[model samples]
Target chain A: MNATASLDARGKSCPLPIVLTAKALRELNAGEVLLVRANDLAFVSDIEAWCKKTGHELLGIVSESGFLEARIRKAA
Target chain B: MGVTEEALLDDPSAEPQPSGVFETELRRLSQRVAELEARQHSLARSAAQEDKITLLVFSNSLDRLLAAFTMATGAAAMGTRVSLFFTFWGTAALRRENVQTKKSLFARLFGWMLPKGSRNLPLSQLNMGGMGPLMMRRLMKQKGVASLEEMLALSRELGVNISVCSMSMDLLGFQPQEMIEYPNLTYCGVATFLERAATGKMTLFV
Candidate 1:
C-alpha cells in the first residue's frame, strides 16, 4: 500500500508529540499511516489514551534502541 | 533492703546498683520508643510527598504561539503531567489544513481565491508593525530563537497532546477533513477540556 506521512515524537512530552502527529495526519487522507518517534515515557499511556479518546488506531509501537517508533492510522 | 533506706540517705553518691537498674533501663527503652515514633511520623510525611503527582495545565491562545510551545516543552521537561488545550482562535492558529490564516485583508483575499489555509499566526508578543515586535524578533534572531513552527514541531516530538476545539471549528465552518492528516489532534469542546482540567491540575487561560 502507498504510505502517507511519518511523524517523530521522540523526546517530546504530554501534548507535543501528539500535536505534531496530529499535524502530520492533518496533511494526509483517511487510511494513511504516519510514522512517529517519541522518547517520552508517558507516551506509552498517552498514545493509548489518545487512540481511545480520538478513535485513531495504533498499528504498532516498537523500541529502536531506547526510543520508540509508533505507527498510527488515521481513522477519524 | 532495710539497710538500703538509711544507706541511700547517707551516701547519695553511691554507684547506681542493679537494684534499680531495671527502672533505668525501662526509662531508656521508653525514650528510644519515643524517638522511633518521632522518626516514624517524619517518615510518613516524607512518603506522602513522594506519592503526590505534579500536574500542569496550559491554555493555548491565538496570539500566544511561542508561549504555548514553550509551556508544553518546559512542563514536559520538568516531568510534570501536562495538558494543553486550544480553543477559539488558538485552534485557528493550529489549522493543520495549512489554510491561509485570515489575518490581513490581503491574506483574506488570497485565502478566498487560493487553496491556502488560514494565515500563519503573527506573534502577539512581537509584531514587525511596532517596535515591540521588531525588538522581539531581533532579539530572537540574535539568540537563535526557533520560529513558532519549529517550537510546535519540537513540542510534538516531545509527545504533547494537541487539541482543537470542535465548537470553534463548527462556528468557523471548518472540517477536519479539510486539514492535513496529523495524528496528534483531538477534537473537543470547551466543556470537555474544563471537565478534565478540574482535577486540581494547572489550568491556564493563556
Candidate 2:
C-alpha cells in the first residue's frame, strides 16, 4: 500500500521511535498512511499499543532482515 | 415466545420439573454478565478521564534527575499527560548557570555545596571525586543513549509540563533569571501540585 509519509527510526531507542512516529503522524491529514522503520524490539508492541491508545489504525507490521516496518493509518 | 419459567412453575403437568434449576442457572449467568458490564463501564469511564502522570522531582542528583526525565519522556511518548514538579534540591537541577552563585550567605553556601543545574549535578553515590557522573555521561554517549540534557529537552518537546515549586525557589533564594527557560513553565505552590497529583493516574516522588 502507498504511504503518505515514511520515517526511518531504525537506530533510535524505545520512546524515541514512538515519539517521532507520533510527531510525524500529527502532521498528516486524517486517513493518511505513515510508514515507520524501527529496530528497537519494543517498537513492535509499543507501536501497537500506541495506535490502540491514540485511536489510530495499525495496518500491518513486516519484520525485515534487521528491522521492522509498520504502516499506520490516521483515524478519521 | 418460549415457555416462561412462571408457566413451567405454575403448571402441574410439566415434565421433569427441571425449570427451577435452569432458571437459577440463567439468573446467575445474567447477574455475572451484568457485573462484568458494570466493571467494563467503570474502566471505560476511568480511561475517558484521561491518563495523567505526576513526577515529583525532589532530588537534584544526576541519576535521579535522569530517572525523572526518562519517566516524563516515556509517559509523554505514550500520549499520557505528564507534570514534572521540581522542589527542594530538585530546583538546582533546573538552574541555568553551572557555576557557584554569590547570593545570600545561605544561598552562597548552598551553591558551593550542591551542584548547579543539570550539567553540574553529581551522582548520588560512587561519585569517586566527581568522576562517576563524568564516566556515566561518557558511557551513556558510547551506548548511544540520550544524555540527561537531551532527555530533559525531549521531555519538553513531548509536551511534558515542567513546573518549579515556588516555595522551594523562595526558600532557596533563587532568582527567576537563574532558572532554565522552559516554554510555558509554571511556578506553583504545593497545593497546586497536590490537586494535580490527586487527579493523576500515577503520582511518583523521585
Candidate 3:
C-alpha cells in the first residue's frame, strides 16, 4: 500500500506504537494513509481496534519476518 | 360516552370511544419519551466531547508512579486530555535531582527521607533495601519498555497537565525551584483538581 506518511515503531512496547500512531495520524490530512511498521505483536489487534474507535480506515496489514506493517487512512 | 366494561364483555370486538383526558395523557407520555431521548442523545454527545481523564497521584513509590505516568501518557497518546494532580507523597516524584535548597532542620530531614526524583523512588512492595527498584529498572530495559523518566518526559511532551498541590508543598516545605521542569505544570489546591475531574470522563486515584 502506498502511504502518505510512514512511522517506524520497531522495538517499542504496547502503548507507544498506538500512541505514536495517533500522534502521527494527527499530522496528516484527512483521507491520507499512514503506514506503520511495528514489531509488537499486539499492534495487529490494537491498530484494528484503534481504527474502529477513531473512525480511521485500516487498509490492510502484512506480517513479515519479524515486523508487521499496517496502512491506515485518516478519518474525514 | 365511553364503552362500559359490561358492554365490552358483551361485545368483545366493539371499539371503545377515545376520551379527551386519555388522549391528553397519551400525548404527554409521547412528549416525555421524546424529551428523554433527546436528553440521552445530548449526554452521549457531551461524553464524546469531554474525552478526558483525571488522575490523583497520592503515592511516590516507583511502581505506583510508573503506573500513573504510564496511564497518563497512554491516555494522552490516544488524544485524550489527561490531568495528573500530585498530592502529599506523590509530589516527591517531581523533585529535581541534587538540588541544594536551604531549609530548616525538620524540612531538611523531610527532604532527606523522601526520594529525590523519579529515578530514586522506592518500590511500593518488596523494595528489599532498594534492590527491587534496581531489578525492575533492569528488567524494563531488557524488555525494551520505556523507563519512568522517559514516560514522564513523554507525558509532558504529549501535553498531559501536571498539577502539584500547593497545600502539600506548604506542608512539606518544598520550594517551587526544587521541582523538575515540566511543561503544563501548575501549582493548585484540591479545588482545582476537583473542577478538572468533574468535567473529565473518568477520574482515577493512583
Candidate 4:
C-alpha cells in the first residue's frame, strides 16, 4: 500500500510508538496514509484500538522479519 | 374436564395458551428488558465520553515518579487529557537543580534534606545509598527507554497539565520561581485537583 508519510518507531517501547504515531498523524492531511514501523508487539493491538477510538482508518498491518508495519489513513 | 386443563395435565410438555394475565406479565417483562438494554447503552456512552485522567503524585521516589510520568504520557499520547497534581514530597520532583530560594530555618533544612529535582530522586526500594537510581537510569538509557527527566520533558511537550499543591509548596518553602519552567503548570489547592478529578475517567494516587 502507498503511504503519504512513513515513521520508523523501531526499538521504541510501548506508548512511545503510539505517541509518535499520533504525533506523525497530526502532520498528514485528511485521507493521507501513514506507514508506521515498530518493533513493539503491543503496537499492533494498540494502534488498532487507537485508530478505532480516534476515527482513523487502518488500511492493513503486516509483520516483517523483526518489525511490524501498519498503514493508517487520517480521518476526515 | 376442560380441554385446556386436561391437555395441560396429561401432556406436561404442551405449551399453555396465554391468558390475559399471562400476556400482560410477558409484555411487562419484555418492556423491562428493553429498558435495561437502553440503560446499558447509555452507560457505555457516558463512559466513553470521559477521556480525561487525573493523577495524584504523592511519592517522590524515582521509581514511583517514573511510573506516574509514564502513565501520564501514555494516556496523553492516546488523545486523553491528563492532569498531574503534585503534592507533599512529590512536589520536590519539580524543584530546579541548584536553584535556591531564601526560606525559614526549618524550611531551608527541609529543602536541603530532600532531593533537589527529578534527577536526584532516590529509588523507593533497593536504593543502596543512592546507587540504585544511577543504575536504573543507566539501564534505561542503554535499553532505549526514556528516563524520568525525558518523560517529564515529553509530558510537558504532550501538553499534560501539571498542578503543584500550593499548601505543600508553602510547607516545604518551595517558591514558584524555583520550579522548573513548564507549560500549563499551575499552583493550586486540593480543591482544584478534586474538581478536575471529578470529571476524569481515571484517577490514580502514586
Candidate 5:
C-alpha cells in the first residue's frame, strides 16, 4: 500500500499553495498521494496547470462546505 | 572566392580531419552567440519593466508578495507612483468588511489574538476549511512577514494606493461607498484600473 499525506492550504495564495504542495510532495516518493485542501479560487486552475506541466497526476477536485480539496499523486 | 592563403592551406579536402566536425563547431558557436544576445535582451526588458509604475495582482496566498508590495509602495512614496489593483480574495486585505474585531484571552488576553486594525478579511472562496488562513497567520509569525492588517497599516503610513474592485464589491457583499476609509483605499471599476494600467510602464497580474 502506498503512503499518503495531506496539506490544508485553503486561504493561501497562488505560489504558496503550490509551493507547500510541492514541498509535501517532495517528502513522498514516487506514486505517493497528497491531498490538498484549499478554498482559494485560483488554486483550482493553478494547481491543475502545475500538475499538467510537471507531469504530476491531479487525482480530482471537489467543492466542500467552504473550500475545495484536491487529490494528487506524485509522478512516478 | 575570398579565401585567404591560411584558409587555402587549412583546406579540409586535402586533410584527413572531419569537415563535418568543423561545420558542427561553427554552428554551435553561432548558436551560443545567439543565446547570449537573447539573454541580454531579456535583462534589458526586465529592467525597463521595473522602471515604470507596475500594476501588481494580489490573487495568490502568501503575504510575502504583499510584503513586496508594501516595500514597493514605500519606495513609491518617494515618488515611484506605485499602485495595487486587488481582485477576488485579494480585496479582503484592503477593506474592513467581515473582519473579526474580537478575539479570546487565550490568544492574547490583554488585548486580542488578532490585530486591532481591520482584519484582512480572508477571501471567502479559499478559506482552506479555515486552516489556510490559520496557517498563513502562523507562518507570518514564524517568517516575520507582516500580517494583512499590519500591512494595511503600513500601507496607510506609506501612502500606497489601494483599490478594491467594484465588481468584487458586489460579489463579496461589500458596499464600496459604505466601506470604512483606510486612508489609502478607493473603490473603483475595471475601467478605473485600466486607466492606470494602460498608461503605466509596469503592470503585473500578481
Candidate 6:
C-alpha cells in the first residue's frame, strides 16, 4: 500500500510521536497509510493503544536498529 | 407415581419438573453464575471511571508548574481524565501576556512581582536570582523530556480540562482574554473545583 505521508518523530519524548501521528492522520484522507518513526521506549505500546483508541488500523510495526517504524492506516 | 421420562420427552408441551438433588444443584449453580456475571460487570464499570485525577494548581513557580504539567500529561496518557484548577499564583502561569491593570498600589506590586506567563515564571529555589529556571529547561531538553509547553499541548490534545479561578482572576485584575484561549477553558469558583475534586479518584494540590 502507498503511504500518504511520513512523520519522523525520532528523539522526541512521550506523547510527541503519538501527537504528531495523530495530527498527521487528521490531514490524510481515509484509507491512506502513515509511516511513523520514533525512538522513544514507549512508542510501541503507545502507538498501538493510540491506534486502538482512535479507531486507526495499525498495519504493522518493524524494529530497526535502535528505533521503531510503525505503519498506521486511517480508518474510513 | 412419579412421571415417566419417556412420556416427558415424547410430549412436546410437557412441563418437566426436577425432583432430585442433582437438578436443585444445577439450578443453584446457574443462578450463582448469573449473579457473579452482574457483579463482574459493575466492578469493571467502576474501574474504568476510577482513574480520574484532579489537580489544584496554586503555585506559579517554574519548577512547580513543570511538575504539575508533567503529572497532568502522565495521568492523561494512562487513560485518566484530568481536571486542573488554577488559582492565585497558578492563574498567572496560564497568561499569554502581562495582564494590564489600574488597581490598587498593593495589587500593582503583586502583579509586577509575579511571573507574567509560563515562560517568565521563576524557580522556586536555587534560582540564582533567575538562572535556575533557564538551566533546568535546558537540562530537561537534553534529557528528552517534553517541555512544559509541549506537555500543555499534549494535555489539550488528550482533553485535560483547564479552568481558572474566577476570584483570583478578579483580584489579580486579569481579563479572560489575557490568558491563552485554551480549549474548553472556564472561569469558576472554589465550589466548582470542590465538586470536581470530590468525584475524582485521585486529587492533588500543586
**What TM-scores do the predictions have?**
0.43, 0.78, 0.83, 0.82, 0.40, 0.68
lDDT of 3 by residue, B40-100 (tens): 9998987774788999999999989888887888888766889999999999999998888
Q: Write the residue-wise lDDT of candidate 5 on B1-206 in tens digits.
A: 23543564578664644455567777999999999999999988756643336455555344434555644443443335667777765554444444343334442231222212234334335567656677767876665445655555555655567777877656655445435576657777788788787766767776
Residue pairs that clash (backbone atoms under 3 angstroms), model 6 = none
lDDT-based ranking, best first? 4, 3, 2, 6, 5, 1
lDDT, model 5, position B118 = 38
Against the true structure, what is every candidate's RMSD? 14.1, 6.3, 3.9, 5.6, 16.1, 6.6
Which of 2 and 3 is ahead in DockQ? 3
Quote model 6's iRMS: 3.7
- Candidate 2 residues lying further than 4 Å off, grouped into runs, are B1-48, B98-102
On the 0 to 100 scale, the lDDT of residue B187 in model 1 is 86
Residue B150, candidate 4: C-alpha displacement in angstroms: 1.9
Best by lDDT: 4
In angstroms, the error of model 6 at A32 is 4.2
Worst 10 residues of 3 chain B by lDDT: B12-21
Off by over 4 Å in 6: A28-32, A48-59, A74-76, B1-53, B70-82, B140-145, B150-160, B170-178, B197-204
Candidate 6: tens digits of C-alpha lDDT, residues A2-64: 788999989987756776787788889999999999999999988988877678899999998
Counted clashes in each candidate structure: 53, 0, 0, 0, 10, 0
Candidates' chain A TM-scores: 0.86, 0.97, 0.95, 0.96, 0.91, 0.96
What residue runs in model 3 are displaced by over 4 Å at the alpha carbon?
A: B1-49
Model 1, which residues run further than 4 Å from truth? A1-76, B1-63, B96-119, B125-138
For model 6, how does the per-residue alpha-carbon lDDT over B19-71 read when each residue is reduced to its tens digit? 45447777899999999999999989767644578999999998888788877
lDDT of 2 by residue, B1-206 (tens): 14666777677788566566687878999999999999999998767654898999999888898888877887787779999999999998888875345699987777667667888888999888889999999988766567888887787788899999998888888867788889889899989899999888889999
* TM-score of model 3 vs. true structure: 0.83
Worst 10 residues of 5 chain B by lDDT: B108-117
Give the residue spans of candidate 5 off by over 4 A: A1-76, B1-71, B77-79, B97-128, B177-180
Best by DockQ: 3
What's the CA error at residue A76 for candidate 2, in Å?
A: 2.6
